[model samples]
Target: SRAINADTGVNKQLTQMILKWRRPGQELLVGKPEYKSVIEASLGIPCRHDELVMEVMWGMKRFMPSLVRREKSELPKEDLLPVSQGLQMLLSSYGFDVKPEMVNDQIVATASVLFDCDAAEKKQYRDFHALGRHLKNVSGIEYENWDLLKLATAFKIITSFLQ
Candidate 1:
């Protein structure tokens, strides 16, 4: 079957409008509906015109990582962390919002959250400001007098009961 453009020619003005709006970063758009809205606003193009074009553009972009090349290397570890493991664990709960690797140096330089490595080796947990901060960060729940082990034990018991 012949395309509609064969019957009624393509809108040159709309084409030009789309060309103007379609800068480099706009190609790999995250949301299709939002992209459609932008296209509709920029060009007077109807919703139905040439879904094939969108399909091909999106398909090419989906494969772009394969097309592009990069060099990978192992990152050095930060054992002497300025930030506490408790805080990193807390922030990691919001992994979408907080990238631990990206801000790790800043966390380390801040010199917050000291841990007792000796106690960890001995399998002993203690009450500290960091654990309270972790509970607050992870669940937005603040307990005035709760140790890390107590919190873990409580959570374990509760989860078992609920299950």
Candidate 2:
């Protein structure tokens, strides 16, 4: 008796056949009767409809992202107001008086340091105040009076939860 398992050669061949028949350029919908008939004839065995559908869906899910072009959408300032307001409230609760408008700048600076900066630059800004000064110069945002230590602490607390 043949051992039936997902890693079998027959399964690999079936996957390859399904992928080729449903190539993205062909734009053929999955689970079509004609597709099942073709697969049955090619393999000289019965093709279960549910199994074929599952294989086709899996193939599309795996490959569609690379084949499709996605547009970047920018959020308007008004949409970010709630986020700024929430940040302001959180800071105020921690006894830091921060303006809501400054919250946006703070978020941008934090993201820039975390994602855009090189490892050396990130190390250079290890001190919260140093990070604030560097970001202020780069973004032209005034950070002279803001409490960098408190803001950094808040970011640490929030990011810890995310991680």
Candidate 3:
């Protein structure tokens, strides 16, 4: 089985190289080898495009981190906003007239309201806040209490909007 696997792997590599050269100007990048192997192994034959895309999405979700921290100026896209933008877009989708800049303030007030509410309200709010805490670490933000509260509120607002 090991010798067969080795032979088949070499054959697939040669086939991939031939296909790469004969097909178009497109070239495979770094991680394609693992992906190609997965596809070939699954079918006991060569890899295909459908398998590649499916595998890439699954692999990215499995291995890649949720949020990547980078300087706004260093980002490839100029129009990208901070995490607050996600909240605004969610609200926008629900036809709310909320601006992205205003989300921060809204969240602060909402969190304050949550804190002052009854026990059940406090629990619910805390649950949402916990989710925000998880995301804060993932986002790699230097968030204060207020910022975290705002993030939690933003998450609630967006989730509600989506629903």
Candidate 4:
């Protein structure tokens, strides 16, 4: 996948607005008429609902996470290494390239900044998030709330058949 230019100016502003105004279970769609009207008025152009959905999806794909590096704690590296490595491989395979390290029992990248890639790479992260949401919907287990060990364990269980 090739790099996509960052959203700037009006597009960036519109993206932020769309994200801020979005509601749960309506991730891609603009459910409220008032929000739609506001978006159209902000752009000073006539836009359809589907077009707004596309814009929201586009913004989601380019959404970047703020990686705040944690100081190394007394947690055992032996316990953290395998989980970190597993996550690193899993994320790298999807083009996110998060070289996650264990910090205070959580898996975070050693680098303070994780998103140095373009929209294509960033989209992979969005896909991963969607996968998590789907898993929650199906199994009633919130993957987003899982810790590093739990995430790695679930990842291993889910991907074991591929091995």
Q: Which candidate gets the maximum lDDT versus the true structure?
A: 2
Give all TM-scores, in the order shown.
Answer: 0.19, 0.21, 0.21, 0.23
- Candidate 4: lDDT over CA atoms? 0.48
Task: Give stretches of model 4 more than 4 Å off.
Answer: 1-122, 146-153, 161-163
lDDT of 2 by residue, 1-116 (tens): 12123233235565576566664444334344555555455444454456546555543443354456472344455534333333444455556665545546455345335444
Worst 10 residues of 2 by lDDT: 1-10
Q: What clash pairs does model 3 have? A: none
Candidate 2 lDDT (Cα, whole model)?
Answer: 0.50
Question: How does model 2 score by TM-score?
Answer: 0.21
Q: How many backbone clashes does candidate 3 have?
A: 0
Runs in model 1 with CA error above 4 Å?
1-17, 20-31, 47-61, 68-163
Model 1: per-residue lDDT, tens digit, 85-132?
A: 445554554352444445554543332322344346335444445555
The residue pairs that clash in candidate 2, if any, are none
What is candidate 1's local distance difference test score? 0.47
| Model 1, position 154: C-alpha lDDT score | 59
The best candidate by TM-score is: 4
